[model samples]
Every structure is written in structure tokens, then in C-alpha cells.
Target: MIIFGTALLAVCHLLGIFLGDLLGQALGVKTNVGGVGIAMLLLIFARIYMQRRNMLPKLTELGVEYWGALYIPVVVAMAAQQDMVSALRGGPVALLSAIAAVAVCACVIAVINRTERPQAQTDGAPILHDNPLLTEAE
Candidate 1:
């Protein structure tokens, strides 16, 4: 089972790389970055879909939990990019702009949350099975 799963993952990765290369060529982007970005997006969507369908147990059975911790190193490496950090270290204008943008986003989120109506809930509800959107769709 582990061998089969590994083979399937390798195939999916190869497919992602091929598709990303084609996409990058069309968009004039570097193949390495585009391929990686595409693969990351595919993984994210797969995770979301699996979670929505309650496939966590299956993932755990496959020992996928260990692989989940691999993202920490990638995140740390991105934070270490000198050029990206330098670009953000401009004069007061850049600092103020970032602050203003964050403040605006916060205010917008707060206003939206305040104006939205709360959902109706029964006295006893199963947290896992209860979703307002799913009920409405039914």
C-alpha cells in the first residue's frame, strides 16, 4: 500500500510539473517557480477537499501527518529572502502604506462581521455534523 501510494504521488507530481512548465512557458515565467507554485496550489486544494469529506482518518492511516511538518522549512526560507525584505524596508511612506492597508482590512472585516446576521442554532447540536450552509443547500 505504501509503495502504491508513493507511486501515485510521484505520478501526480510529474503531471503537475509538466502542466506548470507549459503554463510558465505561455506566461513567460520561470519553470521552477511556476511548477512549485502549481504543485503547492494542488496540494492545498486536495487538503481542503479531503477535510471537507472527512478523510482525515485515511490520511492518518497513510502516515501523511509526518509530511505535514515539511512546510515549516519552506516558510522559514521565504522569510530569509533578502531582496523581498529589502523592498519592504523603504522610507516612511512604505511603512505607513503597509500600516494603512492593514488597518483598512481590519475595519472592513469588522464592519462585515457586525452587519452579518447570526445563524439559528438548536439547544443541542453536533459540532462536526452541523453546518449552516449545508443545511441551506439541502
Candidate 2:
């Protein structure tokens, strides 16, 4: 049950490390490439797949969720620390990738905001306007 989720996480992490190593070798680099991120994605997809197949046990799903929540923040902090250092020292490619990531995130946010704006405006809440005081003149 709970152990199954933990095992799944371990397998995902191992696969992530293997893939990261392969990616590094392919790119003539010497570091793990988004290993934690890949692992996280794998876990999420596995969970989704299992849920869709009605194969996920409730208690085990909760365990996975708890670990997933706990793991993400720690992984993100570690990744950010290492990425900032590497991006600073690794020259143009690293800088370009960081910039690209930012730009893509910005574009996605902008698109989401734009899509929601019209729906928000149409929410049926009455718009208030300044009410003038009643005057004697008819």
C-alpha cells in the first residue's frame, strides 16, 4: 500500500537519473539534467494513469500525495540553487535557457489571464456607478 507509492517514487527517481545522465552525455555536459523534475513528472503521470484505470488504492494515493507535496518544495529549492550557480558560470547557453524558461512562463501566464478576463467581467455582479443626490429641479 503505502510502500507501493514509495517504491514507485524510487523507480521514477532512478529512471530520471538515468535519463538525466543520458541527456548530459548527449549534450557534452557533465551534470544530471532535470532529474528531479523528470521524476516528479513521472510520478504525476503514473498517478493519473492509475486513477484513470481505477487501480489506485485510496490510502496509497494519499501517501503518494503527501510525499509529492513534501518532495516538490525541497526539490525546487535545490534545483534553483544549483541552476543559479551553473547558469552564472556556464556562459551563454545557460543564460539563454533561463531566459527562455522565463519568457515561456510569462507567455503562459499572460494567455491564462487574457482568457479569464472576459469570463470574469461577465460574472453577473452589478456594476456600481456614482449616484447623484436628488435635486429639486425636475
lDDT of each: 0.61, 0.85
Number of the predicted model whose TM-score against the real structure is largest = 2
Supply the global lDDT for candidate 2. Answer: 0.85
Candidate 1 residue spans exceeding 4 A from truth: 1-12, 55-62, 71-138
lDDT of 1 by residue, 87-118 (tens): 57777776787689789999999999999999
TM-score of 1: 0.40
lDDT of 2 at 87: 82
* Candidate 1 weakest ten by summed lDDT: 63-72
lDDT of 1 at 125: 57
Q: What TM-score would each prediction reach against the true structure?
A: 0.40, 0.65
lDDT of 2 by residue, 1-138 (tens): 888888888888899889888888899999888778888999999999999999999988987898888889988898799779878889999988889999999999999988874544566656475445423332
